[model samples]
Target: MNNKKIFAFVIFISLVVASILLLGKDMFSPYVSFEYAQAHPDKYVQVIGRLGNNVPANTEGKGYTFTMTGESDEQMAAWTAEAKPANFEHAEELVVIGKFSREKNIFVADKVLTKCPSKYKKENN
Candidate 1:
């Protein structure tokens, strides 16, 4: 290939690599601590915690309210405008994704993901 063709090919490949790196930077966000989420109320974040002691309560409409206990024992009030998941009570862990409302003192979740115990169930020998 000519010099110009080779140079253009290299530039194209470089641009593709850079674009992928930039786009994927925010694609896989790691779970944030409850404290961090609380502090950054404006930022959309994800928190993984075990289910709280209180039973998940149904809200006035179709929504539901629940609680989550963080790793350091941080108690967060969570509310979702969606029906409670069927496997919620059997979850070993919960991943709540949303922004915190500092004023309301609640983490309004956009989506709730339940980590079922079956994935980690012990098998008897």
Candidate 2:
């Protein structure tokens, strides 16, 4: 191939690789256990689990904090700056996405999603 053609091909390949690497695990499956998240405090990860018995309470700042029980039965502290999610108290399953903060010893949540049970949905008799 000519120099121009070869250069274009290389650029195309480089762009493709960069996109894949830069996107992070979010493009694939980002869900992980609490243990893995704690191990990689600098990386953002998603953890899906049930709410522990403790209720979420306001932080000294503006966010709310609580404990979540991972599917593996591992527990971790989670804090979210957003207002306590609707139905948070009754959520059967919840997913928290954020990076663990070793300084604060908590998972600083960027997003919180709650999955309510079928009771919240309308039933057809």
Candidate 3:
């Protein structure tokens, strides 16, 4: 191939790689601490915490409202449009994926995953 053809090929490959990197960045959103999520309200983040003792209440067809407490004792209210998971009352931990709403001072979750404590315990002989 001529020098121009080779140069063109290299440029095309570089462009393709750059595009993939840029697009892939948005495909994975890392889990962040509650403090970080609160600081960056506009970005999507995943928060892992335990549900607070307060009972979760239904929100007029919008979703459910509950409180979540992080490792550091930082608590935040979270609302999820998704249906409540089975055995939610017995969940030992929760992983919530969504963004914070500064206006409402709550974490508006797109998805909610629950981890039940009893399900993972080994049977005693």
Report how far residue 119 has shifted in candidate 2, in Å.
3.0
Per-residue lDDT over 1-125 for candidate 2, one digit per residue giving the tens place of the 0 to 100 score: 89999999999999999888888556454789998888999887888888887655556578889999987777898898988877888889989988899998899988899998876677879
Q: lDDT for each of the candidates?
A: 0.86, 0.85, 0.86
Worst 10-residue lDDT window for candidate 2 reads: 53-62
Candidate 2: C-alpha RMSD after superposition: 3.5
Clashes of 3: 0
Model 2 misplaced regions, further than 4 Å:
1-21, 24-29, 120-125
Q: Tell me the TM-score of model 2.
A: 0.73
* lDDT (10s digit) by residue, model 1, range 1-125: 99999999999999999998887654466799989999999977889998887756556586888889988887888899877888988888999888899999999999999988785667989
Ranking by lDDT: 3, 1, 2
After superposition, which runs of candidate 3 have C-alpha atoms over 4 Å from their true positions?
1-27, 118-120, 123-125
Candidate 2: C-alpha lDDT: 0.85
Ranking of models by TM-score: 3, 1, 2
